[model samples]
Target: MEEFNINSVQVILWKTMENLIEDDFKKFKNHLKVMKDVPLSKLEKADRDDTVELIVQTYTEEFAGKTVVNILKQMNLNQMANDLQEKVLKIELQPMLEKQKAFEDARRAYEQREEQIKTQAKYAEKQINKGYKKFDQALQDEVAAKIAALREEEEQKSQMMKEKIEKMNREISALSDTMRAIEEKMRSDDVTPPQF
Candidate 1:
């Protein structure tokens, strides 16, 4: 898969064309003319280079190579036919192969991203459920503490009520800070809070 150098392959095809004598070339054309795909008028007027180019245009190098090999073999030029076969890997197939590889790589990356999204969604949902439970418990505790504090305030000194009020103010501030932190974490995770 290094340098394709189509010119090199063309040179090889041209070389085969160069080996053809007048009768051999005529025989070559006769065979090609029979193939419905090969343009009959073009083959008649085509010299060696044009014939090679036309063959390449009509079919791939692989098919052209096969045809050349078969013609040469029929002409009793086995060595030349074998040599052409050796060079006939067909450069046209390489691009299709490369495209296939690129498509596979893209598909794999897409699947990985999809899997990561699923994992993050699961984690975010878990965090939302945890947050809901924590808030429910915190709500119950806050009400219970407030009721307890009210009872104590009625039974206890005025100075003690002032202290409890300050402590309650601090608890409220702490709750606000906790809510902000949770919101920031959800934003970072890019999660929608789960519905009840």
Candidate 2:
């Protein structure tokens, strides 16, 4: 629990009153009247200099009648007003200001988070594209390999068929020559049969 300070309102009142002209004391009193319910401790930090000076000056003056003392009394009343203003400053205004600051901070945090999400999304997209490219290249490589293997197998089969055909042709030509030689020999033997 934070302990609340009670004298800030008085200080504030004094400061506010200090800046005003002497003739404005009556108006200043009206302003103070409006703030009658505000705690003096809250207004401790408030400007009461105006009221203070008015009181001191009025009291010190050699006036025509009891009016002088009465004016001085108004300045005394400022003392009480100041006390409440101080309290309000510490308990109310300060906390309000701090809350405002926190809200601003939260807003900034949200903005930063949004920016980070965007950055992450962009990075993810890049990675996805990169992965797709890699996958596509792998698929292409696989297809090329398969095609090459099929072509190699076809070439091997064609070469084997060609070799087999050439070998068959050579065997057939040798068989034909051998058969003609045998026929020639057999005819020669028959022609010589009467000499035997």
User: Total clashes, candidate 2?
Assistant: 56
Q: What lDDT does candidate 2 reach at residue 43? A: 39
How far out, in Å, is residue 100 in model 1? 2.0
Candidate 2 lDDT by residue in tens digits, 71-110? 3346665544554444444544576788899999999999
TM-score of decoy 1:
0.49
Global local distance difference test of model 1 = 0.80
Q: What's each prediction's TM-score?
A: 0.49, 0.43
Residue 111, candidate 2: alpha-carbon lDDT: 99
Candidate achieving the largest lDDT: 1
lDDT of 2 at 4: 28
State the lDDT at 17 in candidate 2. Answer: 51
Worst 10 residues of 2 by lDDT: 60-69
What lDDT would each prediction earn against the true structure?
A: 0.80, 0.57
lDDT for each residue of candidate 1 in 25-109, tens digit (9 for 90 to 100): 8887787877767888888899999998988778765566677778778778789888887776545456668889999999999
